[model samples]
Target chain A: MKSRKSLGDSEELKEINISPLIDMVFILLIFFIVTTVFVEEPGVEVQKPKAASIKDLEKNSILIAITAKGEIVFGGGQIGIGGIRPTVRRLCAQEKLPVILQVDESAPGALVVRAIDEAKLGKARAVFISANPI
Target chain B: MAIKRNFASSEDMTEINISPLIDMVFILLIFFIVTTVFVEEDGMEVSRPEPSAVQTMEKDSINFELRGTQVLMNGKNIGLGAVRAQVSRLIQGQDLPVIITVGEEASAGLLVRVIDESRLAGAKNVSLAGS
Candidate 1:
């Protein structure tokens, strides 16, 4: 009888209280949810030019990329020059967000100018060119 | 009697299972972790002149012509390294507007670097013009 009682107590003890673990997980989950900003990234990588005047831009702004082939890209897809105005207009409709142009070192200058013109026409709060700190 | 007591105890300890809730929470946590982008983008602002604000070019305004990969001033290739020096030498303690006329074949990177160099040289009102 004593052995059976001991066995029953051990079984009860084996059921570890997991409330603390759930609490920790809940905290972490809430933290991530609160801090998440769903900004679309320009998927392709480009070699950004180095500059001494580069400053930290807004993290929640729109990101557009110009490849070495002069292809205008946004959100992992080639949007072309025509897409800039519409995209910027739609995104900035709710709130005026800055537009950041990530141009490769070898991208053509004409495309950059056109892209800026379109973004300006779309009412971007400001247009910035991404660069590395020299 | 002991078996009856054990059965009664088991019946009395009815707790709601929360394993499913924990699983859902874990999935949400993982999703957020994977989606979070901690990218720190650094950049310089390009202040394009408004189309309605077009005015005659101010005299003594510094002009930089970007052609292919070369920087030019007055039809002479001042080269990339000489941009800051040239702008500062011409600026001479005034808020001289610097206009960059980007050529068709000029690279975007070189143009941005020239703008940055001009800014560093204390040229305040920098603007872009299409070539």
Candidate 2:
């Protein structure tokens, strides 16, 4: 942030008013904070994959937890391929359920893919694999 | 005395004006917004437990232990053809809250896929369990 001053007049120099600018900043900060809604992943604890280049998402929907030992759970509850569609449908109907798959480092790809497939089948619009930022 | 015209020039103003400060503030806001990183959690955790529990897998689940000719479902040894047939019928209309247990072993060949295929065959829920 840069500023300039008006000189040459000792008695009445023109000064730049900054109170409005500061006010604007505060408004924007508040707007971003208020508009952003945080979402928590459900089910068991999931250790996310690490990536050097990961971007932040503003909002997310449903969450799936994958343990390093290869156990998959969701919504604080465990379900299998048989139980996926109904749960997914229930979640998606409320909202488009932007799914995030939090996979453990040791978890295999086949399981992750299956979850994604189920979410899609349940009518979820988008599915993102959770990864830690670098 | 002429006062030497005072040494200060119009361009030599020492005090800074703050209009440009607003521009700088906006620039910073844009930078932060563009650089911020956000993340979403993965869906769920499905793990294979150690084999020692007395609890049994779901009666309707197509539990398979693939050791070439040693295919099993629901704790019974069966042929591949029969296993497939059972899976196709088991995952019909059920969804959510149901479970399909898969065993965990470094050498549990085809068990993972069998679990996946069972899901594809129509199982609503799939999980890995200790057999």
Candidate 3:
């Protein structure tokens, strides 16, 4: 092997620095984490009844909308009424996500109640009605 | 020159110390895991009660939204006057909480009867939609 230069006396070797690389990685990770917005999945396509005092819903719960035409839409799909309970049950068993009920002004009352019953069957602790700002 | 030197050393020595990277990755994964979600879709729908020319509800009373004179609690349909009992059950110890919802566009009287039932059920808090 070739004789190595005198490491210190010749001033040829440099310090092994990983601080800058670590710093750069940290910045990128932070940016990715910060800019990411977590949007909750709305389980149904129910038309929400409008209210004067309703506020823009905070996006941390599953939104379940029931349309006036009796379409049970979820995650943007139309599910029939009989399919609701088991679906909610399976979903809650998998992940106990919050449920928000968005009912249109023209929807059937009993149907709206049925949705809430399903939400209860799913073991959801709270079911919020989606209301609009007046 | 300094940046180039750092890059050069990193490229020359191929093996990366992945232990810390793995640890960090797992931590982030755990965080997202706890925060992940599944959605539930139910079939219930409600047409908001419409506005009518009626008396403004009392300032301190609980409101109930009943359909066809039937009551509801947490989405389950209950019998007539059942809403008041349910409201009392929810707000038993506290004063009546203000319950506000629109009146059915067709029937102002039905909404009033529901309001009356709320009072009978001991609504320390109740309110009607509009006058």
Candidate 4:
């Protein structure tokens, strides 16, 4: 009887408690879901030039791309230099933000300068030319 | 009475002390959630040049001409890889202005690369001339 009682107590102590583990797992899952953010890419792909003075950009800035073929892209749509002013103006009026020009390494220099000029005309708070760090 | 007492004690033992464990897990979860930073899109770093009211041509400026894929430093053809060394050699002791003259048909990428290389070579004031 003594041996049997000891065996029963050991059996109860050996039982695994998994409810707390389940709760922890669920909490971890919720934490990851809440923290995940979707990153959007510019539609066109261009090889950006390398620079030593590059810095990380702010999170809420607008992205503009000039492809190697000299096509201007804003918000995944093709736009001309003339389109830059109005688009930037509307967006900046809502919330003044930095405009990042992702110019292709082989695009025309004139197009890049033109884009910067138009962004200035649109009253963009700041204009940045994107480049990779060497 | 002994059997009844044993049964009651076993039932109490079956109840795991998990409140403190749950509290610790909750704290860890909260810490991870609060410290999490959403990853930003990967891209290059960008800098802004000051806008000038008048495009004044400065003296002692070195000209780099971009025609198609060929890069020219003062009308002499130089490869893209050689640009940094040559620029550093030229701008060693003085902050000579570096001007890049890009043709209308030249690639913008080449121009930016040249500008970056020049800056990396210690050229302080780099400007792009109108095509």
Question: Each candidate: fraction of true contacts kept?
Answer: 0.90, 0.08, 0.00, 0.44
Against the true structure, what is every candidate's RMSD?
A: 6.3, 14.4, 13.7, 8.6
Candidate 3, residue B129: the lDDT equals: 31
lDDT by residue (B3-69, candidate 4, tens digit) is 9998888896856677786776677676667656563433433223334512443446667778888
- The pairs that clash in candidate 1 are none
Q: Write the per-residue lDDT of candidate 1 for residues A25-102, one digit (tens) a residue.
A: 999999999889899999999999899987899889999999999898999899899999999999999999999999
**What docking tier does model 3 reach?**
incorrect
Best by DockQ: 1
Cα deviation at A8, candidate 4, in Å, is 12
Candidate 2 structure quality by residue, lDDT tens digits, A17-81? 66876898967865655555555446565555554323454365766676766666776677765
Q: Compose the digit string of candidate 3's lDDT tens values, residues A43-108.
A: 544334433323344345566667767677777677777766776777678667666766665665
Q: Model 4: how far is B95 from its true place, Å?
A: 4.1
For all predictions in the order shown, the interface RMSD in Å is: 1.2, 9.2, 10.0, 5.6
Error of 4 at A33 (Å): 10
Q: RMSD of model 1, in Å? A: 6.3
lDDT of 1 by residue, B1-131 (tens): 99999888889768868999999999999999999978899999998654543464646578889998889898999898999999889899998788898999999888988999899999887889898
Models ranked on TM-score: 1, 4, 3, 2
Deviation in angstroms for A8 in model 3? 35
B68 in model 4: Cα distance from truth in Å?
Answer: 1.4
Model 1 segments more than 4 A misplaced: A1-14, B1-20, B50-56
Compared with the true structure, what per-residue lDDT tens digits does model 2 show for residues B38-119? 6443222233322332144444344555443355655677754564467666656764222334333322224433443454
